[model samples]
Structures are given as C-alpha cells and as structure tokens.
Target: METKVAIVTGGNRGIGFEIVKGLCQKFDGVVYLTARNEERGQQAVKKLEELGLKPLFHILDVTCEKSIEDLAKHISTHHSGIDVLVNNAGILDFDKAISSYEDAKKLIDTNFTSLLTISRILYPLLTNTARIINISSDWGLLSNIRKQVWLDRLVKDDLTVEQILEFVNEFLNAAKMGKSAFFSIAGKYGDYKVSKVAMSALTFVQQRQFREEGKDISINCVHPGFVMTDMTKGMGDFTPERGAKAPLYLALEAPQSLKGSFIWHDCHHVNWDD
Candidate 1:
C-alpha cells in the first residue's frame, strides 16, 4: 500500500498549527506543515517535535505559482499522491494604512485567487478518495450576498468554476472603481467575505465536477468560527484549537457524503444557500 500524505498550508501558527498537530496525532500518514517563511515553518515543526509530534516543514507561498509547483513536484517525487489538502493560508487586512482597493486586491489575491491556482496546479496529484478542506468563514454564507441576482447565480446547482471566477472578478473590478454598491453587497468585511463566498461556491462546483467525472475525491469548505487569532485582532469567541476541529474532521474522518458542503466549526453541515 502507498503511504498516505496530508498537506496543511499556513501551518506556522494558529488554527493551521493546531490542525497540523491534530493530524499528527490522528492521521496515519505524513503530515506536512507548510508556510511562506522557511524559518517560521521550520520553527513550527521543531516546536511540534518538542511536543513529541512529528510534522514535516515546507515553504509554500500560495500566491506564488513557482512555490506551489515546486511543492507539487516534491510531493510527486516523495509520495504516490496526496491524500488530504487543507487550504488554510489567508489574510485579513483591516489596516487603515492601506487604501480600500489595495486591501481588497490583496485579500482577493491571497484568499481566493491563490486557492484556485494551487488547486488547479496540484489537482493531478490528488489520489482517489482524497479530501480537500478549504478554510472559509461565516462570512462565506450565501446570505451575505444581499444581491438576489448574485445569490441566484451562486446557488445554481450547475454553477461552474468559471462563473465563480467571473463573480470574483466583477467584485474586484467594482472595488477597483470604488463602487460603494458592490461593497454594500457583501456588507462588512466586504473583500474577505466575497473571497470566502467564492471559496465556498468553488467547493460545490469542484465536488460536482468530481462526481460527474466519476472520481472518489471529496471537497468541502468550512467556517472555523470566529477564532481568536491575529486575523481577528484577538477578538473572537473560539480558540485556535476549537477552530481546527471541523476542518480536521472533514480532512480525516467526515463521510464522503459530506462533500461540497459548507460546514460550521461543530462539524454540522450548513445550508450554503441559506
């Protein structure tokens, strides 16, 4: 039998770190804790090792194609294929120092576009029955899209990845133009919300495509809850460990039937259209 392998991005700290720890304890496979900074990534791995948990370190800047491809090549050479992937790298820049458009562009690029790029690039390396867990947010809920037309498009059972991309691009263009209307469409935390919403929609589209192609892969997006992390400015109700629970469940133990769903931190399936 081939050795099982799991990859967790942004694993240097917070929820990503906890997910790595959990997988190290429970997953009967090699768990890679990837981060953009080599030093921090190695440090995190060493810390886990001190706790008597084994986790490998790799440098992965999700926004960089070369970085992603290099990691993909490494995985292909070292393992038969990937068994689980957790897309946990993201940013939340509410800093008033930057312009709103700049912030929006950065958020979309890191949180949404990078995900699409990495998934497309590494998709061929996924083994049958592989699990993909995208770390989304409560803001990803379809209800956050106040515009009925946008909601209708996203909720379509036959929604395509192209459509999701178009939706994201439209928001980007609007943000570029400083369109307050588009910002209102997603309400507070507009850029972050739209990016996550796109992620959740993409999850459904990917799962549907997998089914149509007769692949055994499972994909789901999750809201890790408002965890107290640097991204949240340390003002959330849950801790990073609690935030990792749902994502860990989906990656290692959730039923395949749970594919394409948006899940809460408690592991309950959330109605994406609701």
Candidate 2:
C-alpha cells in the first residue's frame, strides 16, 4: 500500500481534533494535524504522542493566503501530493442579525471563504484519486428550507457548482439587505446557512471539475451529526468523537466510489436542494 499524506485543518480541537486522532489510528500515513496557533498545534501533537499516536503539527491559518502557500511549499518539498484534505476549520456566530454587517462578514470569511481559499491553494498538491472531505451541515440542504419549495427546485438533479454559487451570491445579497425571506420564513440565521450551502456546493463543484478534467481526485462534503464540543458549549448531544466519525470515515475509510458526495454520518445522502 502507498503511504498516504493527509491534512486536517483545525485539528487541535473539537471534531477536528478527534478526526486527527482517528486518522492516526485508522490510516497508515503522514497526518498533518494543522492549527493556526503553533503552540496549540504542538500541544495537540504532544498529547497525541502521549496517547501513542504520531501526528505532525503544521501551522496553518486557512484564512491566510500566505499561510496556505507556505504549507503547500512545505508539502511539495517534503512529500508527494496530499492524499486527503479535510476542510474542517469553521467558525460560527449566532449574535445579532444579518444586518450586523461585520459579524456577518466574519462568518463569510471564516466559515465559507477561508475553506474555499484553502482548497484552491492546496488543489495543486493533491494526488491522483485523492480525497477532499468538506465538513458541512444539514442546514445547508434546501430541504431544510421551511417553505419556498422552488429554492429546492434549483438544487435538484445534481445541480452544477456554478448554479449553486449563483444562488449563494443571491442569498448573501438578500442577507445584506435584511430581505432574506429564508431567514424570515425558516426563522434562523440566513447568513450561516447560506455559507454552509456554499461550502457544500463547492465540494460538488470541485468533484465535478475533477471528473471533467479526468483527474482521479474525489471531493465530498459531509455533515457530522451534532456533537458536544467547544463550538456547541457542550449543548450538543453527542461527543466530539462522535461528530468526528463521519468526516474521518469519508476521508479515511469509505470506498472511493462514495467520494464527491454530500452526505450525513449515518451514510444518508445529502440532498442540497432537498
């Protein structure tokens, strides 16, 4: 078997942490347990070592182009192309409303744009038939929309990535004007949902692009079931380990054919439009 190389962003804590731990045990490869903070990343690595797991710490700030480029350079020099890339770093804010422009923009930059930026930077370093597991959520699915069934209509039938981005831009514009009918009707934060929808859409877009380019890479998005972690303040019912299961499964264990899927942990297919 080939020696695989994997990178897990935000691997110092929460589901990201557990995914790194799980990967160390489940996959035979060099696992880069990445964190933006050098201290935190190394501490996590130390703790993992104490637990008999070996993982390397890489300083990665997914939001920063320089950080990502540096990582690409390091990987290019030290190893072959990456075998798995888990775009797991994310941020959340339930404060105020979409009209809080700064807060909303923070969400966009963290939850959506940073991952996209990281993906773009690392794309050149992915090996043939590599796996890209994007952590998403049920909220991204159009079926979660309370009404406006037509919105679901737009995402039906393996909707192309370009179409998904168009809708995402529309929703962002709606949130900017405080006219997000989805928020009003769904009674939730529209910006966050729109961002995840965009994230999930990006996974599909990349998957298809790889297919069209005849590349063997497989990019898939996954929704780890809600789990208790710092992100949830222990409110979630499951543990971080539980949430980590899905992303790790998709990234390290699932069959290749299941790649490029937007799915939930129970192996249920995600209907982004539904």
Candidate 3:
C-alpha cells in the first residue's frame, strides 16, 4: 500500500505545532510540518522528535507562487498525492489601524489570497479521499457582514469564485479611498475579521465547485477558537493543544457527509443566516 501523507502549513509553533503533534500521534502515515522559515521548521521538527514523533519539514511560504508549486511538485513525485491538507497558515496585524488600506490589503493577501493560491496549486495532487480543512475563525461568521447586498451574495448558493474575488477587490478599493467607514465591521481588528470572512466565502465557493466536479474530496472551514497563541499575544483562553482538537477532528474524524460545512470549534455546524 502507498504511504499516506498529511501536510500542515505554519506548523512551526502554536496551534499549528499542536496540530502536527496530534497528527503524528493519530495519523497512520507521514505528517509534514511546513513553515516559511527553514530554521524554525527544523526546530519545530526537533521538538516533536523529543516527544518521539517524527514529522517531515518543508519550506512553504504561502504568499510565494514558486514555493507552493515546488511543494506540490515534490508531493506528486514522492507521495503521489496528499491525503490531508490543513491550511493553517495565516496572519493578523493588530497594531495596524483597521482603516489603513495598506494594512487591510496585506492581511487579505496573506490570509485569503495566498491560501487560495496554495490550494489551487496543490489541488491536483489531492487523492479522491483527501480531506482539506481551512483554518478560519468565528469572527468571520456571516453575521459580521452587515450589508444586506454583500451578505446576500455571500450566502447565495450559486456564488462563484470570480464574484467573490470581485467583491474583495471592491472592498479594498473602497478602503484605499479612506471611505470604508460605512463598513459595519471596520473597527479595531477589522482587517483580520474581514480577511477571515473572505476566507470563509472562498471555502463555500470551493466546496460548491468540487461538488459540481463530482469529486469525492471533503472540504470544510473551521473556527479553531480564540486560542492562546502568538497571534493572540498569548491572551487567549484555550491552550494550543485544545485548539488543535477541532481541526484534528475535521481532518481525521469528520464523515464524508459533513463536507462543505462550516464548523465551530465545539464541532457544531454554523447556520449562515439568510
């Protein structure tokens, strides 16, 4: 039998690291720990090794197209395809004013655009039974999108990726003009929230497309909860291990019937209000 493989991006530390540790303990095959920095990736692997868990390290900078392509090629050549993928790599800058166009653009690029690119690049290498879990946040709940028109578009069953991209660009354009004040969620940490919303929107789009293609793959977005991590500046309530449980459950335990669902950390399905 071929060796199964799971890849977790941003696995060098925090929740990503905990996810890797859990997979190493549960997954029946190789668990890869990927990070943008090689040195940190190696260090993370070393720490896992201390626990007698072996995790492969790969350099992955989600924002870089070449890096994503390289990882995909490697997976294709060495493992045939990936059985599991956790898009845990994302960024948030609390210091940047939410209204700053530059800051918001950067957040969108890293949190949404890069994940989209990486997913597309590695999609070809996904096996029929592959499970793809997108790490999103509760802050991205559809309720945050107060504009009726925008909310309608997002919840539309037939929403297209092109349309979603257009919506994101439109928001960015509005932000550039310093006129995003009308946005209901454009307050402190608004960029982070907006980016997560976009990510969730993309999740729905991808799930629909996959179903339309008649693929057997399972795709889902999840909120890992407000965990105590570097991103939260260690001010969160849950530990990294506790935060990893939700994603781990989705990756290893969720049934095929649960595909395309938006799950909360507690493993409950979120109802997107119409």
TM-score of 1: 0.96
TM-score each candidate: 0.96, 0.89, 0.95
In terms of lDDT, which candidate is strongest? 1
In order, what lDDT does every prediction score? Answer: 0.89, 0.78, 0.85
Window of ten residues with lowest summed lDDT in model 3: 179-188
Candidate number that wins on lDDT, 2 or 3: 3
Model 3 TM-score on a 0 to 1 scale: 0.95
Q: Model 1: residues >4 Å from true position, as ranges?
A: 95-99
lDDT of 3 at 56: 95
For model 2, residues 175-242, the per-residue Cα lDDT tens digits are 56664554753346766776787787677767777888988888888888877777666777678888
lDDT of 1 by residue, 211-272 (tens): 99999999999999989988778888999999999999998789877778889999998798
Model 3, stretches more than 4 Å misplaced? 97-99, 179-185
Best model number under TM-score: 1
